[model samples]
Target: MPIEPQALRVLMHLVAHRGRLVGKEELLDAVWGNHFVSESAVSSQIKAIRRATGDTGQTQQVVRTVHGEGYRFVAPVQEEPDAGQPPRESSSADEDGLVSPADQDRPVVAVLPFVDLSPAARHAHVARGLTQDVIAALSKHRWLRVLTGAATARLAGHPDVVEHLREKLGVRYAVEGTIRLDGERLRVSASLTDTAAGVCLWGDHFDRTFQDLFDVLDELADMLVATVEPEVGYAERNRSSRLPRTDLGTWDLFHLGSYRFFQFTREGNGEAQRLLNRCREREPDFADAHAWWAYAVVLGMVYWDTEPTTDLLDDAIQATERALRSDDQNAVFHVLHGRVQLARREYQAALATNERAVDLNPTFATAYCGMGDSLCYEGRYSEAIAQFEHAVALGSHDPQLWAFRTYGALAFLFAHRFEEAVDWTTRAASIPNCQYWTTAHRVVALAQSGHVAQARTEVPDLLEQCPGFSVDYADHKLFYLKRTDQRELYLAGLRSAGVPE
Candidate 1:
């Protein structure tokens, strides 16, 4: 702790020169600058530097004396230029690793995957559900990006997640706790810990009747969100946006639709679409029902070029309007409407829709993706990257993997990370019933990324097969030819990428 200033400089000098053998005379010259210091002083300072840096040993030297020459700093270094890379190894092994990963552009948090503390009590389901719900709950917060469950699972344990969270999640704090059940009551206790100082910022417990599972889970989720919101420091929307509603069935239906829509197949699409439709019928003014229905339309048409109904688009517009009418603050519904508009070639309308959606729910995944799509149509690439990255943070369900890949490709293409674009688009091609939009992006990505041969060979059939043969081709242009520059860039990219004649 009392290493002199001279010793501190010496240790840093060694680490700064992680490799390359430096003579002890060089160290003295660098730190002492020709001062009349004795060789003994230099040797003593070297020892102090080594000890301070925990480089314990005569042979195991961080600063090795080259027998008659001098000392050299010895350490293997690995640093990736692309900074968003996830931690490759645990930082518990590195004494100097302390930076948390909150890239100013992307909010970050860690999900402490629920631990099955009582394998005997059979609470795995409850625990897993709680963690999942908490992630979902935290997700609704506009200011924080919760680390995906898989990323945070490596950080699990009683207080085990503390430091791991700071170093891994790059979050200032983490939400962690345990679950228990006693006869008729369900108990949950959670605390948010500040990783930097290792202190508990907040904690709460909820106890509810066995049948009150829904309410208890929601309350805990709410508490977790509200507690973290203040700490995250996000600018809030107007009071109307923050107002709570009494409606529950609509949200229930929405979650159900979300749960079922993930199969990425025809039937999964049909079931989810039907439930959302019924949801609107049961609650005529529920905007989300209509919005989701529009999304369903995209999937349904995955098998044909003709639309389900001539008024299918009109239905989406109506539902979005209804959602806004009942609660203009509902960003999700507006985003749904935007998705329809984007598909329909109404780029400006789509952009406005997503802007409002983002204003209402900054964390909304589809809203940002919609905004990205709108910008892509308009050829505004940089802004699109920022928005799409947000969509990735918010996370979409399985049905959205294709959508994700599409956005990822766009993000890379527009941002000029062309190689990455090709890689993501290639992955997207395998998605079940991948839409033309996905394939089209892949075409462009591959071409621009220097895989022009493959791009040219695959795009024509893809573009011709737009909408999986389900779109109302008469109403759908299947390509954006709004700007000559945009059209040229696209066509050139596609040609280079392998779009057929």
Candidate 2:
């Protein structure tokens, strides 16, 4: 009797490790490779193999579950070569577990069907609609490859829904929820999970009156998209961190590089650049890798106290242009390009680029922060502060929270809200991996707000960490500020804080 391909692979893997008691995770790694599947999938495959071999779960003649550990194959079979076919290859049975070439390096997401859970099941339609809307919104992100709602609908009542999705569809993440309507009230609860780890990274419930269906759908879709993006990013970073560097694909490399890029230190920035460049080299057509590589280069110059050389700027611009040429519709690419534009001191153009990014994906927090940076350069400090505020609200748990808070502090400083600036910088400085600049910003805010003695005390530490930092360097490197008064305000604070001229 012929067995399904997956079951055949499972049989081969078990036969290869017969009597060794392969753990679930080991089986997943050896049989499914990079794909993630729960223990249930392993059991399912074993059952199929046993049925083909005239064995039952009760008999335990072919395979045995070790209970809380793994499975063991007790019965062994001898390998024989058929005369009409080439000899069967030995010891390479697990190669089938590796991801296919086309699917390699692409992270997939599945939005499973939402359960109605209403008393009368009348909210089924609403739940389905919400799932579709969420899938559509998540598709706009460009980084995520969202499986269609219809495709995931088959998994509605599976005992292992997330694992089934991961196993069958190669999904790394899953979005699942339920919708209920009772009288005039509507409630939708949603969660994002890392299917591999079987962990929920984020979950929330949206409660609204059942007045306008479309309005409710729109609000929930926006919230899910905004929340999912950052949470998925955080999950990806954590996953990549635990994997061996050799096992990482281009997607995981990009995530790892992003984690490093946000550390806001010179060494971390250098590592980020290296990792992103490796991603670019491995997958030349991966536009996001190119975009992030460019951003990593720019971060070193702007925040990590590195020299912003003309050659570095040119390389960054070229990489950004390449990314846009490949995927012009990516809001993140536009945001990164805008950052490079900001570094070039083309404030208006950067602003327009970031505006286009926001138009592309309004839920993206970094785009708002990019717009805030451009606005601050144009001397619209109040508008800039508002944009930063909006961004912080949208992505409170963002991995780049340090950068956002630091930017908000700069906006407050430019607006001459000295105490608020001090508060913002103090908070920013407290966050792990925040840059040396947070301390600098705090010092400036302190000195400007009449706490001169306290500000002077921080000078030694700042100088020690960021050698050669002086007001002159700020004047020369911080060309994004168009107005002389704003520039002088920054320099004057540094001077008052006893920074070297």
Candidate 3:
């Protein structure tokens, strides 16, 4: 039952003046300010508020809209006092519709409509299509608050676009791009800017054949968003690190924790958990924190080889449940739930949950990775490999690129495509901070493909990295696979590669 921030702002404004009809113009000015979204945006937020509160346009039990005017909070209400503050008398949101102080700590990004530099602006529609697609894709990330395209449409040609966006909309990051159609080829250049510093943090160009405009738009947007999301995260983590540790807010803690979580090490996982714990303590309903904590819990047990105590599993499950309870429609929550289910050896349940996640956010690479992992466990190797490929394509620059490649390697190995497994594992191991298990996959795949001597040569490096390496650990890692022969094949490869026990 997560109400959107804008909707929540409107809701608070209505409730603050309970029983009084608040005019649409007042709400627009208070909520949108100089950002200049249309009245339709206000209406949409009202609709969202009603949906969240289980009230409808027809019923209007909670928020009563005065036709062609504004809205009123007509529901029975009680004034609740803050622990140390006075009873609320005004909206907690600022004039620009930004929610409470805690919420302002979250990163806000705006994707401006891409400029069409084509002849006579012939490709303007394609430019708009790409902008909208990126906006939709970025919105899937639970950690990010993406401004609707309409909110930034008017700022497309501002002389100081970044400063204007920052001053007016409180945007931390802004994405701007230009589309140029040259003959049959389309060239799209996009950049992400840090609004505060007015620095371009990242930039890239996509050149496509421009055969099917929509298809090209989808592909380019997926590529751009996948790359930009990680850059934004990296920027946030760096920004948070520069702030005083003692003054770190909940969002800062969450970002710091997320940075550590992707390091793929036991110590990193533990540190991530500690940070996320502090984050949740500060904001008990921060669904992103809860979801990341849940994933880190499973990571400790699965990838880091920490003992999987019953209590640990329960902790992961409870965190996921809490996250979903806070925001049921979040794709990341569902993806994390799938990961938890996979850790518990609930193969079918994992697959189904991951499917739901992909349905919610098709551009979310991790959801596809979850489905791939679940499919691998179900012995549906071909399908799993396809998912991994799609995931890699969508998230080529993902911070968790190692995980996606490692999952692909496993999927390939499980399918007895040993050469492809070796190739994928090699790619994964080449990534910075990739875990020893990734190397282990390469060794097993090599041995299976009749390269036992070469595999044996790599075993020493693997043993040095993971001092307690053994066939038993391999068995523990692959326990989720339902097919006994699949597990045996993996173990036999490790055995051939000269792993102990």
Say which candidate scores most in TM-score. Answer: 3
Q: TM-score, each model?
A: 0.45, 0.75, 0.81
lDDT of 1 by residue, 100-145 (tens): 1111213356667665554367877788787887787666643345
| Candidate 1 positional error at 22, Å | 78
* Model 1 misplaced stretches (Cα beyond 4 Å): 1-260, 298-310, 396-402, 411-417, 426-440, 448-450, 456-481, 484-501
Displacement of residue 496 (Cα, Å) in model 2 is 1.4
Pick by TM-score: 1 or 2, better one: 2
- Tens digit of lDDT per residue, candidate 3, span 53-82? 999999999999889867899999875546
Residue 167 C-alpha lDDT in model 3: 61
Where does the lowest 10-residue lDDT sum fall in candidate 3? 86-95
**For this target, which candidate reaches the highest lDDT against the unseen true structure?**
3
Q: TM-score: which is higher, 1 or 3?
A: 3
Model 3: residue 325 alpha-carbon error in angstroms? 1.7
Q: How many clashing pairs in candidate 3?
A: 0
What's the lDDT for all of these models?
A: 0.61, 0.79, 0.82
Error of 2 at 146 (Å): 0.5
Model 2, 266-361: lDDT tens per residue? 888899999989977665656777788888888777766557888888899888888788667889989999999999888898999999998989
Error of 1 at 460 (Å): 12
